[model samples]
Target: MRETLPILRLLSLALLAGVSLLSSVALAQEEDGLDIGEAPVIIPADPADAGTLQPSPSNPAGATPEVDGDALELDRRVRDSQPPVMKGGKISPDGEADQGINIYLRMGTPLPELPPERPFADEPDDAYGAFQRGLFLTAVDKAMPRAQLGDPAAQTLLAEIMSRGLGVKRDPKGAAFWYGQAAQGGDPAGMFKYALILMEGQVVERDKKKADDYMRRAAEAGNASAQFNWAQILVSENPGVRGLTMAMPFYEKAAEQGIADAQYALAQVYSALKDVPKEKKDRAREWMHRAARAGFDTAQLDMGLWLVNGYNGPRDYELGFRWLSIAAKRGNVVAQNRLAHLYINALGTSPNPVEAAKWYVLSRRAGLKDVGLEDFYLGLTEEQQKQAIDQANRFRRG
Candidate 1:
């Protein structure tokens, strides 16, 4: 099945739950980073014995128990809190303005980056090769010895298998143990995974301090996602200029690595910093454009507006219309509203009342009401109004 934004969000939360570390590793690979040998653990639709897994007597008191179904549901609720802004203008769930700085560009906390290639890359053929080929039981058998011998890769692979119940019973506690070992063995990915487990307090005791330390280690070890997240933490805890200054380099590093959210965050930071030179402020537009081109809908909306209004450069109505159209098609209410205005005013193209009315209706349905657009719609002839509504319905269906 094709992956949707909602599905990806759920998967991300699952990563936070420490049950899908391999999936997170695979995502890092897509960013052209280090390769952890392929082990894309698919979440089974009906995991075998999912109902039978229960917390052991050894579980820490007051720690959340991890029943397979309950864990999945809890992950879903966590994901729902950070819903994708299908119609809302906000960039992310956590985004908000503070001290006159617009910090809505950064998304949620970052996940771990893929650790550097394991030193035993060539030697682990039996275990990794078997895991990659779907022989989960065989892979586990081969990996166990190396894992016991303190191989980070082997330990991580075992963690992945145990967490997902691949050819074995699901064992989140066992997964947590292996992940901790892998982290201690100097694996950046393991540090990230183990950190998340510690933070969640499921299967392992909650230790916010320990989690922060592990996250810092992962970030310093060159995990781009970790760098972005750690930067966010630092900025949040220290909202002063000094704090932002400290976070800047990490954001820059992550942005340089092609993290679009990081690029958006940097753009906001540069744009909002007081007393910055004009050239420096203009750099915000550059990063915004980069992020927009990389598929960040919020940046696309901002870029379109900036281009249309000549905020940081000469006005380019045609280019602005293009960007606005791209975001509008992606269901951005603000973009749709702006696209309607552009159509009505013939800013980039010939005025088309029908198209304008269609966009206005769509935007209005998404909770953006423009009085002028409403008046214009009311003045349209009955036939034109009917045609506009039909077009709006078609767009809605698409």
Candidate 2:
């Protein structure tokens, strides 16, 4: 509701299918409200026999939507791979924190800056080798000498180790200092880390101008995270298509480097920008599909709807249904709600009153309240309603 006029003027999801119009959502929610839409108008199977769910005559039973070879390959890829771009510090499937970044952080005041260099000789397997093998303390010891000698790489290693607290106490202040040093010495990693620290203003004095400089430098140096984040920052600084246009190249570069978030951004860019070339607009399909396969649940939700409604190309209800089912299983509440619609309408698979109600129940449990689904559930027979409830209760998100 607080969105700017420029964002409101941009293309909305309504252009895709039955989705409502919404301005370009902000990035803070991590793509929330970017793809999901309300349920389409539900045409009863037969007005005369409203109790039974049936496909509308226009959709036709046994509608054999053509199978796409590219889609088949995409299915194979998404089905086979684990999530491609897990952020550091997030818990994994097994609920263990990613030892990658979080393990290194200990929330405390920064240690005092190191004294002048001691006579410690460096080795081929110096700080980096030890750090890679999880020897955080040793890495710090080895890196200190070279860092004091103004080696950017060694400074970067110390910064990372100190920031992550890799087998050592987290020294945010020390990390900030080393990160700043490494950035000054032209290390991309240091630039990106230091830029973030500067932005946060907690670990050091807040310096937005310096943060932007380091972020831009790191992005130009081809750090994928830096590229995606820099694009987001650009969009934030200059809203609307003008901002998006300026950010496109960086988004593309990041996407090409396998950043799922960037791929999703490009998909939005092409879809929302009306003046884009036909070929470029068409790339939206590829980008959306790629992002979905990379475990971006929002992309997966949109790809399903796009395929279902032929927004990208031919309507393939079956493929859309499969994708929606996948996202629903992955605990996307919007996907769950839409999957319920698919079940009731028999868009992709055979309809079961129980399934439609069950999906609605699951989505409702997640706090995605849908009045349409409420009515649909209310209309079910009591016996069927009980079955739906049982199924919903038994179901667990995969």
Candidate 3:
């Protein structure tokens, strides 16, 4: 009995040791939620490595036989395939992130690389290329040398840059100087710019005569804007035949270049001159139509009225209505009044009293006093008036 008792005591101790080991292992697994066996060693890859793996700095030999708890948790979360939570913070309804925390935690360990730097200009042509590409600083760098060397195009470009402060500080005086230099070099654009500077008198001295001279030079050089301005200068003192004859050629040159203002001016000249020939009036109508088509609101209104009244051309109500409608849409009050007239009379389109009332009210609101339009509006039924009021409200809101 004594021998059997000893053997039982040893068996009890052995069982206790086995149970203790198992409890320890179970506790570890509960904490880590990893395998019971020793975790396989993991190596992190070098930054430059193509595919080789090496040991992670966080995990080392003999630290723990179990997998890392955080790593295991991350793995489990990944394996469960749940939608990723917005790490570190939440996004508010206003499209802002929570101010208390960094919302970029989900971006992992490393940040993305930055974008490449913008290229700088290396040469004169490169400067122009950069300027064309909107790299104004690069343009200035490349053109500075050439401008200093008296290159007219480069000087003009620098002048533009200084005037507009493109990729540099604004210097109107410097721009004027550069423009003067370019003009002296016989650059037409430079002459035009310098003429404006001279006229403004803010950057340089006010010299209208010098400005006129430069403008004339620019006009002679075939600059469209210069030609228009020069013609105006010549005729400012004299609107008689001699002045007209002097300016006519320049005006024609500018008009042929698609200058809307010049076209309108030419039309006015032909139409207003007393005792002008029928051919001149016809040319006036043609020029007015050209300006109208170019979206000049005044020209549109004049052309519309002329066409409707059979002045300078045959009466074409349809064409008149189109021009008036275009001008009205551009908020020309005169055009709106005319359009309302056309609408009420069904001249070119079906008569719509509601539309006419709407336009009449709009024009009246803009301080246009039209007795006929007021009478027409007063004649509309209550429902039609209400609809017109609603349309006016929409138009006003817009």
Candidate 4:
């Protein structure tokens, strides 16, 4: 019996590895409610509760969440189930009512991830290595001799340095010249930048045909940004499920290369298109989770509701609450409002009126009005209100 006891102990320890485990033990645990915990709490989506969320409140944002923004206007019933619409180069929510379905263009703020600057990607020579180390001036000096001798890779290095004004006066025209030379020399990064310059017309000339050619070439050559943009162009030109089908490959490519925007777009393609296969639709949640984890706030917001409403799979209210909390912390107004709902209703957490009010206060200050949140505030005690305000103030100071 003692000898057999050690064998059992060893077997139990081996089960912890998960692979080649004892099925009987697993079955026992399953029957006893083990696994990744029980099936999550689910809130069914009522289709009748659609197209009623009033996003974009008229009031300009205040410095901090206020007890009162304007008159008590309570257009606060949030809903899902709105179809996606192709509008103005964006796959937007059909009515701007699905709080998380609105996909904004990655514009105005420049994405720092564009134009790969890895010193070791190809030429790990001193010049490229110098650029990697923030020695931009040194990079230019070492790269110039090679650049003058018509080295396209070196030319690309010079273009990136000049364009970003890393260590020298910003000379976009000079960068354009270098980029053009590199493009001619068959550099994918150079081609992508040159294509953008041509399209912008301000940096060079607005030759869209030429720009399109260059972009296509760059995309085919495997520039992640070019791949994503090329997909957008295909959608804009074709404008339907056919266009989406054509562009899916490029979006997949870009998403695989860690482009968060591309990941979110892929999710939208799967979810918004009714013609998508059930297997492919299942991928929407996966891609959305990727985008959200990559810090795309909108994706995070959507992931929260999707999990709660079981849009893609079974509900997991705990994870949904977590994602919504993350977006709320990052200052997503809609998330803040929705998170308040979660908190007050005890969807994924214990009902804490104070925490709910705190989140609502943040959203209200950001120019979003929620009548339900207002009523929630009115119901809180004066002490709870002060505590909520204080909590919000701490978040503000940070």
| Tens digits of per-residue lDDT for model 2, 28-84 | 122221233433322111101001111111111222223222211111111112333
Q: List TM-scores for all candidates, in order.
A: 0.63, 0.69, 0.63, 0.65
List of clashing residue pairs for candidate 1 = none
Q: For candidate 1, write residues 1-398 as lDDT tens digits.
A: 01112212332233222322422342233322222122222221110110111111111123222233321211111111222333333354455423212233354445456689747433235776676656777777777766666677677777777777776767787788878877877666667668778867867888979988987897788766666666666665565565566777777877887767667667766655565567766787798899899787766876776677665556688898898889888887777888888888887778999998989999899777778789999998999889989998988421
Best by TM-score: 2
- The list of candidate 3 runs beyond 4 A from truth reads 1-130, 240-242, 274-281, 396-398
Off by over 4 Å in 1: 1-142, 161-171, 240-242, 275-282, 396-398
Model 4 regions lying over 4 Å from their true place = 1-126
Q: Please identify which of the two predictions, 1 or 4, would achieve the higher lDDT against the true structure.
A: 4
Instruction: Arrange candidates by lDDT, descending.
Output: 2, 4, 1, 3
RMSD of 2: 21.3
Which predicted model would earn the best lDDT? Answer: 2
- What's the lDDT for residue 113 in model 4? 60
lDDT of 4: 0.65
Model 3 Cα lDDT, one tens digit per residue, 1-398 = 00011112332233223222332242233322111121111111110101111111111112221222221111111111222234334656665556544434454545557699888553236655566656666667766666666666666777776777665556777778878877876777788778878876886778878888898998898777777667766665444555665676777788887766567667766665555577776798899899888777767877776666655667787897888888888877777887888888787779999999988888899888788789889888999999998998787321
